[model samples]
Target: MRSAAADRGAVHRPPCRADAGPDDLETDVEEIQNSVYWHDTEPVEVGEPLDGDASCDICIVGGGYTGLWAAHFLAEAEPSARIRVLESHTVGSGASTANGGFVGLTAGKVLRRLLWYYGREKAAGVYRTGARSIIDIGRFCRRYDIDADFAMNGMLQVVTDRKQLARLELQVKRSERTGLRGSFKLMGRDEAQERIGSPQVLGALRTTGALVNPHRLVQGLARVVRGQGVDIHEHTPAVDVRRVGNGYRVSTPTGTVTANEVVLATNAWQHSFGQTHTKVMPVWNYLMVTEPLTDAQLDRVNWPGREGVSNSLSFAHAARLTSDNRVVWSGGRWYYFDGRDTGRGHIRNAAAFRDLRESFARFFPAWDDVRFSHAFGGPIGWSRTFIPQFGRLADGVVYGHGYTGNGLAPSHTGGKILRDLVLRRETEYTELAFVTVNQPTFAKGAIGDTGAHLFVWRQETGDRLPLMLPHQAALAPRAFFAGRAARKARAADTGR
Candidate 1:
């Protein structure tokens, strides 16, 4: 088997940074294409679109991880059942190929919210499930001979300032109380810096997370699914879905699929349907990849474990090394258009790319000369509760989505949940906290747009507040998040 990192070679280097203006930064990326680095790693054979009417036992709408995983599991469970996956573009062309490829465990704000809503046992169940998903993905890759650069090297949730440090301390205490003491190891400033050579890292919480080449993972999974007799159609967008007798009819641009069961696995695009319009909010995230680092450049960072690193802020930044040694830097501010627009037009935002470049320079000043080779953006589904939700929408229609930003590993759990729901089984997956009947939805129209803007402002502002200020200066935003969690928990309990 070929190693995922051994194939790629370096490109031309750009001018080094020296307090350069925005124009100079623009020059650095001027020649770079707005494309995902993962997609360019290898060539993919695109499948044919649906040409006419079709029928299947199970129809999955979305060829990303969720849908592909669901098909894989369903095929394993019921070999006689016919499964089909519909994709708007190519498989894994959206967030799956564009995200920072950290197969993460639930942590930071997401874990906090899970603990608040569900008690310790339930929250721990979710964590355990997430952890198992990571292992399961590795096993699946090995079983299918998919060389996705699967490395279970773990991840570090670092604090850049004193305020974040305080918050990380509290989070550690909470995790300890929740019986997850062994899941994370707290590291002081020096120890944290040893793992990751960054002066900004005040403290770190190390968790058992893994990383993978997401494009290879998804594409390999699609091939496995197709080999298992599942039909996958690329460039076949589901235009509409409606109830037809005992089944559901999914209309696509060129054909229609009538199936006994339907799975709405279109992560960010789930908002396009009425049943999920308010249930999911589509937010755009941007990422940039640098040219492959030289041995000396890698030695400067001294990231021997090559663990994925992300900060502990509401609008956090995450960095990880690709299989080919390029640094993938992502996350600063999430963008939401005035309307819920998930079009190609929003994929390349100049402002977001500039912010990403500047933030990367700040975090790893040792790599001041490293130039970015690729920049791209994609939409991710953000639930109001900040966790993924999957259950039946109607009798024959089951959906799984709202992964927020971390879906690679959990989507494995989601596939099992979806499989059980479609089979009407009362298994452990069906009892998971996020698998529910009536999940909460965000506000609609102008209210939702305004609220999303305000939420982003609060998160970014909280992260940007000076450490010299009093601790109380950051209390307002913290309180806001806490209050919202409480309200969401209450609403979920009351089925509102």
Candidate 2:
């Protein structure tokens, strides 16, 4: 099992704290509706709810990858278990579908951090669980006859700067110390250039990973669970859940569901629940797909092959070639920490876009001038600790969230883990690191926005300090977080 932590590191080192580009544009809902990810083509289309109150053995919320996969695993574990899924929107509508289809396996420095915080045994356990989850995803696709273009192509961690090169050097050594799958193999600048077919590439640290069309994959999983006789209700949002004896009573707008257990798969939408917890909001992650390159331009990138790759530069980016011959890429920087929209949650501002255009032209001069076919942007969630926060929110209520920017395939793994938790299965998934409790203080919309803006600004745009410089940088915010959590704890004790 690979570590699921690759994309789940802390709010990225080069945090997002720049001024908002002066513009306000409505997101293209039509683009979202007409996406290749979700088209109405399922064998048993349960687009509507059961029409009234219903009872199931388990009720799952949110139809994104997490909820759907949870339903699949539950049916697999118990063929006769009565499972019902409730989704707020159409399937694959959220981050599950729109993310850059990179199933990141080489959990960058996540393993390194785990070894530092917890002992080797505990950290290794989580890594094993996470790695196996990736393997499980591939296996499940084949088992369920999913054709979301599952590619076993690994990822290349591009190294651009000498400082970044040194970071990779330390990362490689750290991985070895923490028992990485293979030796940290470093490719030279020329070697990286030749291997990735990009002349601008200096060096690379490649690792075993995968690239899957995330939306297609989740849609396929949704189909498989229906084949198993589980009931799924799309456009159904589970708004509230209260413990009823040994089970729960979940409420929706027009109906309610009584279940012995409930799984909360709504990562970004969890705050809608009237619970006092640290929540992740919509942080628009802007993405764009270039038109398929011409033969002459293709030769410049020579992408050798279509594989997922992200570099270590500040506000670095990740890219992959789609089956349609389009290049899909994502920018690596966030704007706020308190979960507010920063310039509509953009990856590239005008200045940044100009530089990005230059970089593209620099790497693949042919692509430099190619116009984008479509641009998509939305939010991805993250917890304070960076890794996913998954566990029982209460008795008979288990949920997971906070993948940050790099969820892709790892969220699938979390799906499996949450399934095991629901079924009480004692597999290797048990030993993995889980953060069930990170009590957070309450902040109104105004205060939350203000604090988040100020903190992120100081961490990112402020030249006085760096966001991630060992212990020196985190001292202030960590203390702030502790204070917030303590305040939350006190409030919970009194109010609840």
Candidate 3:
């Protein structure tokens, strides 16, 4: 087995304050600087890279959730078949563990957007698939005894500014109309504060989004799959994959893997594959975690449930409590790596870190005395549509990637979809919207890059613009209300 630490290179710390003494808040910030909270908790153990020539019944690339889950299911379905997973870095190195640990559905408005693309039945089916994925993941954790700190403590999508109130309210209405499980409910200001105690919160939409120690979850999944007779190789990057006769030949620096079937489970790095290059964008997102709050400090927040919390901004701000009582903050700002460069060096964004710090202070003024312990970033595969792209790229070549940032639950469901595709079996999983639908590929070259930049720019600018123009403060809410009313009127008129 290879040491996972070798791939991590050097540790990058946050900006230090020269004026501060050893006894001040600067120490807290430096404590967890430039490392993932989950990975820092435990040492990751991974196997050696693929050496020489190898052959398998199924070859899966990338050791993150997508590849691990696919291998787990495939090994179960065909016990006699040979299974191998090749990862470029250590297991859980990508978005799998480097995320905000949000186990949520890609439903909400994305469900409604599906209605526009597909019909009502298909849209509802798509929404239900994602909703059920949340349940399926929790059940798997319990059944396998993977103690990843699985918490079904629910999540709160709060609106900090008045401009966001209508949007939050509309989501509640949409969830009700879409017949989502009885989990999503509109909360008044007082109720929202009781749940999260953030002064910026005006209202919230509460739903059963689980929180987990993502690092533990992925590590556990890898362990379980390996126990079931799956071979996993770390520090092995699949440099080239080409069709050879009835199977595909995957070349790596250390060796070559020829398999009857190949599944590309690489997420953000999917762009490196010619078949998926234009189909996904490898963009980076940032996160920061605070030092463990004191018992007295925890009381000031009043969140006994310790639910996951995120605001309703387009470039939304999200925060969740860890088992150790530290708050992990992410979003509010994201960046695009011009040429799909997901090198480890690109993971540190000083600007994104500063923005996250300022936003955290604004949202939780009561925590002024508190300082962050860690700050880090990771790449997320963004499809043209903010949903995942799933299907068979060619015979025996199935691919799953691009969950935007909501990969935890979706990846579990996607894994099953890949299994069905690999086995050439038609089941409910094969008919789901994400698997059956054709996702539009992003424009290649400068056009696609420019569009991606502008999309991110619009969200960042929109969130900050209101502060500059007090006169336009009420416009967003009014516009949202007007749109909601129009949708309601159309539904009533149709009487369907």
In terms of lDDT, which candidate is strongest?
Answer: 1
Q: If ranked by lDDT, best first, what sequence of candidates would result? A: 1, 3, 2
Q: Relative to the true structure, how large is the alpha-carbon lDDT of every model?
A: 0.84, 0.63, 0.80
lDDT of 3 by residue, 1-496 (tens): 1112324563544433312233543453444457776887667766898889999999999999999999999998999999999999899899998899988867355765676677667666766777788888889899989888888888888888865674565565556665663656656667778888888887677776899999999988999999999999999999999899989999999999999999999989999988788888988999987766788888888687788988888788898988878788898667896777788886667667767777887898787777565688999898876778888875457899988888998899888898998998999988988777768988778888898899888877887655433322234544544554576578668986
| Candidate 2 local lDDT, 144-184, one digit each (tens) | 78887878877788765545555565666667666863623
TM-scores of the candidates are 0.90, 0.78, 0.88
By the lDDT metric, which is better: model 1 or model 2?
1
Worst 10 residues of 1 by lDDT: 1-10
Please report the TM-score between candidate 2 and the true structure: 0.78
Count of clashes in candidate 1: 0
Model with the higher lDDT, candidate 2 or 3: 3
Q: What is the lDDT of residue 390 in candidate 3?
A: 83
